[model samples]
Target: MFPSTEEGPEDDSAKHGGRVRTFPHERGNWATHVYLPYDAREEFMDLLDTLLFHAQTYVPRLVRMEAFHLSLSQSVVLRHHWIHPFVQALKDRMASCQRCVPRAPLCLSSPSPPRLPFLS
Candidate 1:
């Protein structure tokens, strides 16, 4: 899935890999969007992989995650007004995912209450 210098650019991917292989940064823009076209799966996966890679290697403090989906906590004002609905939506999504893809891999982390695994 990645380039190996020893294999050289002349290897199979050299001719087959599309334009993204030539300019990886172009994929970043698409990731920022709320929705992306299905055709962009490869690009999106590449972007996600890159994001996780940097988060793990550079920002190790975040306990970097590989799970793609994310849900932000509501703003304090909105939370007070719509906490129940927001929780329901989040629960529904999680339940649906759990049913549809049981045992699917996911990464969950809490940065504020950090768990130092190596400490023990």
Candidate 2:
């Protein structure tokens, strides 16, 4: 039998300075994730600007989001050889899912308190 070449979790943590890997590290493998992109309309931008104006008064370092998206899945590691097949399988799985298009104005309910360094 071939001896296991995979590194233990402790070794991974030591190599990466204790931060958890989104996916296990393996030769020829890459971390992959998927998300649904959000296309903000002009109205949404206006609302965002108004919110930022108010938010900045309390948190001076607050910044606007460069882009917005909703995550569809957690990160998964994929071997280089499996990339094409995995993408094709994902496409097939998504084909039958209903398309989601938001029509109403997005609303924020009970905004969470910001955990700014100054507040802490």
Candidate 3:
């Protein structure tokens, strides 16, 4: 009779809804994210609250964001050596920029469900 092999760690990918990590973990690399801040107004906040309330029927554990913002960049790997220079450059660019209000109107309704294969 053959003996059973040992397992190292329990794989709990479903704990995060089967989401995959974008970047591989390495010692000196850091994941950097850049985003634009969104300050929702009273009417917008009410609408967002209503939407979230409706969505919670399907996703009970969902919660509202204290600070909601649009992501400007995906997770990018930055070596430890480049962290300071990258932050300095970003700061310099942002220093001269005016308040950014999105030019387009917000679409409150989804036209159709997204075609992302993972959801299915």
Q: Pick the candidate with the highest TM-score.
A: 3
Off by over 4 Å in 3: 1-20, 92-100, 106-120
TM-score quality measure for candidate 1: 0.22
Q: Rate the local accuracy (lDDT) of all candidates.
A: 0.40, 0.68, 0.68
Clashing pairs in 1: none
Ranking by TM-score: 3, 2, 1
lDDT digits (tens) for residues 10-120 of candidate 3 = 546677566566655665788777766778889889998999999999999777767877765556778999889888877777788787556787545422332212112
Candidate 1 ranges beyond 4 A from true positions? 1-42, 63-74, 78-120
- TM-scores of all candidate predictions against the true structure: 0.22, 0.54, 0.58
Q: Of the pair 1 and 2, which is ahead by TM-score? A: 2
Report lDDT (Cα) of residue 39, candidate 3: 82
Model 2, which residues run further than 4 Å from truth? 1-27, 104-120
Worst ten in a row by lDDT for model 2: 111-120
**Candidate 2 clashing pairs?**
none
Candidate 1 structure lDDT: 0.40
RMSD of each candidate relative to the true structure: 20.1, 11.3, 9.3
Considering every candidate listed, which one attains the maximal lDDT?
Answer: 3
Q: lDDT per residue, candidate 2, 1-120, as tens digits?
A: 344865543535655445577445666777776767888879889999999999999998677887877655556667899889877877777788887667775644422332112112
